[model samples]
Target chain A: MSHMEFTGKTVRDAIAKACEELEVDEALLDVEVLEESARGFLGLVGHRNARVRVRKRDVLKEVLEVERPDSRYTNIKPQEFSEIESFSKSGLEDGKITQEGALSENIDKSEIVSQAKEFLEGILCRIPVEAAVEVSVVNGSIELEITGDRSGLLIGKRGQTLDALQYILNKSINRETPLEEKTEIIVDTEDYRRRKQEILRDMALRMSQKAKKSLMPAALNPMPANERRIIHMILSEDKEVYTKSYGEGPLRRIIVYPRKAMPNKRRRR
Target chain B: MKELVEFIAKSLVDYPDEVNVSEKETEIGLILELNVAQSDLGRIIGKHGRTAKAIRTVLNSASTKRKQKVSLEIIE
Candidate 1:
C-alpha cells in the first residue's frame, strides 16, 4: 500500500498516531519523519506539527529478496555473511544504535541480557516490524527471542535473513566490547531454529541413505551456512557417508558422498 | 539389526534397563529407532558422536551379510 503522511506535535506522537490508524504495532509501521516540530517566539505561537510518512513494511517483498534462487546463500561462515551488503542492508538500514554502556571483560548475565535487549530494541525501532526482544543467557552465549506479528518475515526463506541479522549483531556487539573474549549470540523467533535443526537433521539422514544406495553423491539445495553445518555435524562420524559443501556462493550446496564398498581408502581424522 | 543396536546401546548407556530399540521394516530395508535415559544420552553419543558411528558401522557390516539395508536413529 502507498504510504500516508501523519502529523503530530512530535515524532513519537506522530508514530503513535500512525500505529493507531494502521492497527499495527509501532514496530510494523515504516516511519519517515519529514519535519520536526519547533517551538519559536512565544511558548507555542510558531510551533509546527511534526510530519511523518507511514506505511506497512512489505514483508513479502523483503522475503522474496532474500529467497531468490540466485545469490541466496552466503559464505560458509556466518561472520562472512555480515559483509554481504545487498542482502543485509534492508535489515540493518537506518538502524540507530546507542552506545551508552560499554561492555566489560567480566560482564554478568543480566548485563548481557539488558545490553542485547537494548541493541535489539534499537535495531527494531527502525525496521518495519513490531516485536519484543526477550534476552536470556544459555550456556555462555546470549539468546534472543523476537516475538510479534511480523516476526516470521525475519526468518526469511531458509533463515538466511535471520542468520545474516545474527552475524551482524554479533560482530557489531563484539566490536563495541573492549576485550579479546567474544560472546556468542543466538537469535531465534518462535522456536524456528530448533524446528529447522530437526528438519535438517532428518533430511540429511534420508539423503545420505539415498546417496549410499545409488553410489552417487547426493547434492542438497543451497542452504545457509548454519543449516549446512547441521548436516555436516550430524553425518561427520557416520560409517559409510561423508558430507561436504560443493559449490561457490549462491550456487554453493552440500554433497553427501558415500564411502566406498571396500575399505581401500580409509578416511582418517 | 534390532538386537545388534539393542546390545550396543545397552552396553554404552548407563541405564541399560532404559535402553529401547525398535525395528521397522520399510522399502529402504530396515530402520532401528533407539531410546535411552536422558542422562546417558551423551554417553551413547560420545564425543563427536564416535560411539554411535562405530555402532552403525558394525550394524552396516551385519546388514551387508544379511543382504539388507539398515540405519540407526538415536532418538532424543
Candidate 2:
C-alpha cells in the first residue's frame, strides 16, 4: 500500500504534476483537492494543499505488462470458449431468437454489435460534414441516427447511400466474426430520409410555380446524388416544367426549370 | 507473433498510416503496443471496445500456432 500528498497553487497544476511523475494515462486515475490554494497577503507565498492516491503497483504492473509480456503464454490469453458459447445460448433461451437465427445464431451478439458500430463510424468520419451518425441495435437490426444539416446526403434517394453503408458493414462484420457465429445487421437514420422526401416534393412544386411566373429557368442549390434523383422523379409528370441535375459526385444538385408560361407547379395530394 | 498482430491492426484502422506496433520481450511472454490516430482510435477500439476484443481474439488464435502468449493494447 502507498499514498502521497502535495500543495500547489491550483488543483489542475497539482494533478498535472502528479500525472507527469506517474507516467500513466491521466484518465485512469482520480484526483481530489482537500483545500484551496492559500493566497496570503499579496498572492506571494501561501498555496493550496491537496491529496493524491495512486494505485502504484497496479499501474506499474500494467506498464511493465506493456513493456514485457509473460513469455510462457507466448502473448495469448487463455480463452474460455465454452463460457462464450453459454452466453450465446442464454440469449436464445428467451426464444425471441434462435441459435439457428440468421447470423446471430453462430456469433456473439455483443461482439457483432461493437464491430458494426465501429465500421459505421469509420464511414461517417470520412465524410467532411458537421453532422454525426449514431448506431444502435434495435430489434436485432442496426439503426443509424444521423443529425446535421444536409442529411439527405447520407440517406440518399430511396435510401441508396444508406443501403450501401449497410452492405459494407455486413461484409466487414462477417469477415471479422468467428466462423461459428451468424449475425444479421441493418442500418437506418431515424426518420431523416423519409422527411427529406416530403420536403423535396414540396420544393419541386415551389420551383415549378416560380418558373411559370418568371417564364425563365431557375436553378436550386447543389445536392447529393440521391436527393437530386428524388427531385427529378418528383417533377417528371409536370408537362409545364423540367428538371436537371448539375455538378458532380456527392455534391451534385437538382435544378427545376419551368416552362415559359404556366399557372404554377400544381399541388399533388 | 508481433508482426502478424501489427499487420492486422494496421488493416483494421482507417488511418492505416498512423498504425504503430511495438513488441516488449518478457520472461513469460510478449506485450504488444498497438497505437493509432486519436481520431481513428475509436474505430480500432470499436463501440464499448467489442471490436478491440475481437482483434485480440484473432491475435490470440494466431499466437496459438507458435505456442506463445500475446495481448493487444490500443494506444490513443
Candidate 3:
C-alpha cells in the first residue's frame, strides 16, 4: 500500500495523477478528499489537498500466494468447456473410454462419477463393493456437455446440493490459481447449467416482447440474484420493456413491465 | 385487517401452532401485528428484510385489488 498527497483542481484529476503514479485501477483504490480545491480571486493560485490510498497490485500477488498455495493454476478459458464436453460425448458414443480418458473427457465425466461414487459409498461402505471417484482438469474447468448422469444428484434439493458442490469447487480452484491471474471459479454439471442460462435468456427476451405487446407488467418465477442478473443484462437495451427484480432470496423473481406504465413509480415500493 | 394478518402469519411462520396476529383498524388505515415462534422469525424476515418487504409488497398489491389500505408488522 502506498499513500500519495497531491494538489489539483478536482478530485478526478488528482486521482488520475495518483493512479498514473501508482499504476493501479482507480476504482479499486480508497480515496478521501482532505480539502476542497480553492480558487483565488486573481486566478493565480488555488490550493487543493487530497490524500489517496493506492492499492499496489503487486503486493496482492505476494499476499495471494500466501492465501492460495496452488496459485499457479488460473485464467481458465470458457471455450475449453465446450471442447471437453464434445470430446467426452464423442468418446462415450464411440464405445471406447479409457480408465481415464482424454483430459477434457476426464474433466467432464469426473463430477458425475464422483457424486455417484460418493452416494454409493455412503450407502455401501459397509458392503463388499467399493466405489471410486476421479476427476481430471481439462482446460481447468469441467465441460458441461460431456458430463453424464448428473441430473439426479446434481439437481438435488432444488439445486441446493449442486450449488454447495459448485461453491466448494470454485473456492478450491480459485485458491489453486496463481496470484498473478487469480480468478473466480465456475462449476457446471451435465448441460443443465448452460441450458438453464439459455432458458433464462430466452425467457427474458419473451417477457420483453410480451411486455411490449400487452402494455402490462409480467412477473417471472423467482430466481437467485445471479439468474436475475442474467435476465436484466439480456433485456437492458430494450426500449419497450423495463425490468425490475421482485420477491426475495433464492426465489426472487423479475418483473418485466412496459416502460410507459408507471414510469415514475419505484418498482419495489 | 385481522384476516390479512392471519393469512400472512400462517404463510410465513414455520411453527404454525404459535402463529398469532392482532389487528387495529384505524380511521385512516389498518395495522396488522404479527407474532411467531422465535426460531421461525429469521425465515420470515430473510436476508436484509428482503423477504419481509416482499411479503409486504404482495400484501400492498392485494390491498389495491380490494381498494383497502393495510400495513404489516412483524413482531420480533
Candidate 4:
C-alpha cells in the first residue's frame, strides 16, 4: 500500500485525523512524522499544522519485538495528569520533558528541601554514625548526601542500607499525596551511588554484547529493585537483545536474551 | 551454616534434586560451598548479584551472633 499524508494543528491531532480517516486504531498506524506542527510567530501569525505519513503496522512484528517503542501516556486524560507528575521518557537521551528547568513552578523547593533535611537528621542522630546530611534540590529531585568519617557503614552491603534510607525518605514525603504528586528523592554517600550507576551501565552494555555474540541469554547477578531498573533502562533500546527480570523479589535478576535464538518459550501462537 | 544455605538454594531453584552444599574450615571462618543446576543459576545469583549478596549477608549476620565467621561460595 502507498503512504497517505495527514495534517492537523499538531502531530497528535494529525494522527487522530488519520486514524479517523482509516477507521483503524492509532496503534495499528505506522506514522512517520514528516513535519512537526509549528505555533509559528505569536499564537496567530505564520502558524502551520503538522504533517505525517501513515501506513498499517505489521501485527506479528509488533508482538515479537521486546519493548514497546513509545505507547505510554498517550491515552491518559489530560485532566488526570497533575502539574508535578514526572515526565514519561520516550526518547532515551532526550527524555520526555519539553522544559529544561524545574518541573512545576508552584512547588516550594526550599520548604521541601528543609523537610527532607530535617527528616534525615532525625534518623542520623539516632545512629552511632557521625554523618551530616547535606540536602539540596537538583533537577526536580531532592538529593540527600551524607558525609562523615564513618559514613561508609551507612552504605551497607551493596548500598542496601542506603537504598532503604532513600525508600523511607520517599515514602514519608509522599505518604498523603496521590500518584502524580509524588516527589523523587535521592540518597547518596561518598560518591558510591554515582560510581555504582556507571558500573551498572557498563555491565548492561557488556552483557548485551555477550548475548548478541553467543546467541544466549546473559543473566546478571541478582540485584535490588533500583539497580535492576538501571540495567533495564539502558538495554531497553537494544534491537539485537531482549531483557527480562526472572525469579522473585530480592532474588530477581535480569537475563539479556539474544533476539533470534528460540528457547521454546511457551506462548499462544 | 551448610544446611542453612542448602535449604535456601533447594527452595529457590527449579531442580531441587540438584541442590548441594559442602563445608570446609578456613582461616577466616567456616566456608559453605553451594551448588545448583546450571539452568537455575540465575535464580540463585539474582540480578547483579543482589540475591547472592543477600544470601551472604544473611549468613554473616546469623553466624555473627554465634561468634562464628562464615562465607559462602556459589558454584554454577
> Which one wins on lDDT?
4
Best DockQ goes to which candidate? 4
- Chain B only, TM-score of each candidate: 0.94, 0.87, 0.82, 0.92
Residue A234 lDDT (model 2): 62
lDDT of each residue in A1-269, candidate 2, tens digit only: 12344445566667677677777576856555556566576766654354444333445335324322113222222222222223333344323433345445533467667667766565554343355666666555556666663535555545655655555455466655453453556666658657778898898788878877777556777764445556666666676776654444444555555544333332122
Give the TM-scores of the predictions, in the order they appear: 0.43, 0.30, 0.34, 0.47
Candidate 2 structure quality by residue, lDDT tens digits, B28-74? 68888888888877767765565675566545544554467777766
Q: Which residue runs of candidate 3 sit more than 4 Å off their true CA positions? A: A1-151, A172-182, A262-269, B1-76
Model 1 residue runs over 4 Å out of place are A1-109, A177-180, A262-269, B1-76
Summarize candidate 1's per-residue lDDT along A1-269 as a digit string, tens digits.
35778888898899999899878898788888888988666955787889888867757445434222122232133333322322333344312221222233246767666766776565554343578888877656788988883536666656655664575456445644533346778988878889998999899999989988977567898875557667766766576776656444455577777765423222222
lDDT of every model, 2 decimals: 0.66, 0.57, 0.53, 0.68
lDDT of 4 by residue, B1-76 (tens): 6665665565456797999888989898898888888998887786567567656754553464346888899986
Residue A174 lDDT (model 2)? 62
* Candidate 1 TM-score to native: 0.43
A186-268: candidate 4 lDDT, tens digit per residue: 98989888999999999999999998887666889998656766776677667677666555556667778776674433221
Q: Which ten residues in a row have the lowest lDDT in candidate 3 chain A?
A: A67-76
